[model samples]
Target: MARLVAVTAVLGLLLAGCVDPHTWPEDQDDIVNGPLEVRTHWQAFTLEQPLQINDEGRQRLHLVLDGEQYESNDLHDPKDYVNQFNPRRVDGVLIEPDIILVGDNGNEVRVHGTGSLGVRTGRLILAFGTHHGDFEDFLSRPPAIPDDIEHFEALRIRSNEPFTIEALHWSVDRHPDLHRCGRRCTWLERWLMGE
Candidate 1:
């Protein structure tokens, strides 16, 4: 009975630590390596559509998801947009600001870009643009993408403000449209076809 009680107590404490009490627009405490919550507002693909395997070769698709974070405190205006932080070069020293992405599985991907980045003091708008590569082995195992859907619910970005690009269950699929040339095209295809 004592052992059972101790185990239960430990489990309870561990679970408590996992809970994040800070809510968006209210919590902006950490500016550097701090947790910022980002909600997915929109997403797009670099290629017009999912790359189809042609000539028995491998295919890859580039995905982009845009997210945003808000600061609704006296320190920041609730209605203002928090831009991403930008690094500067001082005295020939190159300072690079970085943001990290944390997936639902605890895997992390680093975000690198200067788009929508802001200064730490005067700016609050942080724009999150994340890219992922999806590779398909045409010869061995072709991607069985159902109706051309891409699932990215397990992806999130970590920065001064935590950004959730999409919900853990988010999925995106491409549907054929008449005007889109009966199939989506990418720069690769354009180059290959010499168009």
Candidate 2:
């Protein structure tokens, strides 16, 4: 259908924006209110719980995610992480830089977290899909906590080339010391990740 074709064309354009976390932006606010395609990459949190970030009344890009929860609607056990998050409202504002977290090479106040985020450029596209988890199954393997088994600092503004500290699906849930054990992990990751 022509409608489907138009949608595909629009999506192709937005995705081509190179909305990676490392893509530095001159104005961070632009990202705070860009298209869902771009904005969704900026921040993600549930209304039941939000990261209240502040710093001496100054403004900075608040890259924050609540500490892992042991039990909740999204999670029933400590072993359970966010199974599949949906960012109904992805938004943020440019605030003051984090003083405690700074880079050794410089002092730009490095910030990182496992959340959705994107560079604020020019765009207008919204894609709906799973926002988190799909890897909590690893917790059942023992010694595989959410923190260690997962890492996704979408926007750190790091001095290094690899500004973001994101881990691939495989790296996050390393294969157990067994045969074909990674099958479920791989399938789950791909499914929830829209792959």
Candidate 3:
């Protein structure tokens, strides 16, 4: 009898992780319809667009973190940077991201971006970009930089699909005297672009 009871308890614990729950936290429901259904469908998109600086004197540059298409030269000429997410496709639209992650934040931050791609039943779309500030700052107050560079992760979601990392990049020129985050940042960009 004692052996049977122990076996049953162990079996129950094993089954818990495999069970797919239909519900999610209320805050997460908006982007993803539900927990189990949304996180599994999550995927990463990569763009071929190169990084270019803007002429507004802001010293800003645009990066393709994840998406379907690439921006054209005409757009780059004027420093428009409007098609940040490559918005030409009819199926999946590239969206501007609202949420960004930087470094290890003690806890993982959730996605809170404002735009959406017309993702269907089994797909989730993610867009990527970069800026010259602590990626964590977007979520809360920026953190003190111990090193010149850091890598950040972003997540995107849709109904019942798995939570997916939409984009990953390092902020190279975040500090005043610092120029670039060095080879690690460059390597991350190359890896993301599948170069």
**For model 2, the run of ten residues with the poorest summed lDDT:** 161-170
* lDDT for model 3: 0.29
- Residues 58-172 of candidate 2 have per-residue lDDT tens digits of 1233322222211111222233233222112222122121112222232223322222333223211111111224543522332212222122223322121111111111111
Kindly provide the TM-score of model 1 when superposed on the true structure, using C-alpha atoms: 0.23
Candidate 1 vs 2: which has more TM-score: 1
User: Residues 1-195, candidate 1, lDDT per residue (tens digit)?
Assistant: 999897657544433443333321221222222132332332222221222222111121111222223221223322222222222222222223244433333444444332332333433333323322221221232333333223212232323422322211111112111112113455433343334
User: Across residues 1-195, which tens digit of lDDT does each residue of candidate 3 receive?
Assistant: 999897657544543443332321111112222222223344432213322222111121122222333222223332324333332332333333333233333232332321123332433332323332323333221223323223223333332212223333222222221222233344533343234
State TM-scores per candidate.
0.23, 0.16, 0.24
The number of clashing residue pairs in each candidate reads 18, 9, 17
User: Relative to the unseen true structure, what is the C-alpha lDDT of residue 41 in candidate 2, on a scale of 0 to 100?
Assistant: 25
Relative to the true structure, how large is the alpha-carbon lDDT of every model? 0.28, 0.25, 0.29
Best candidate, lDDT-wise? 3
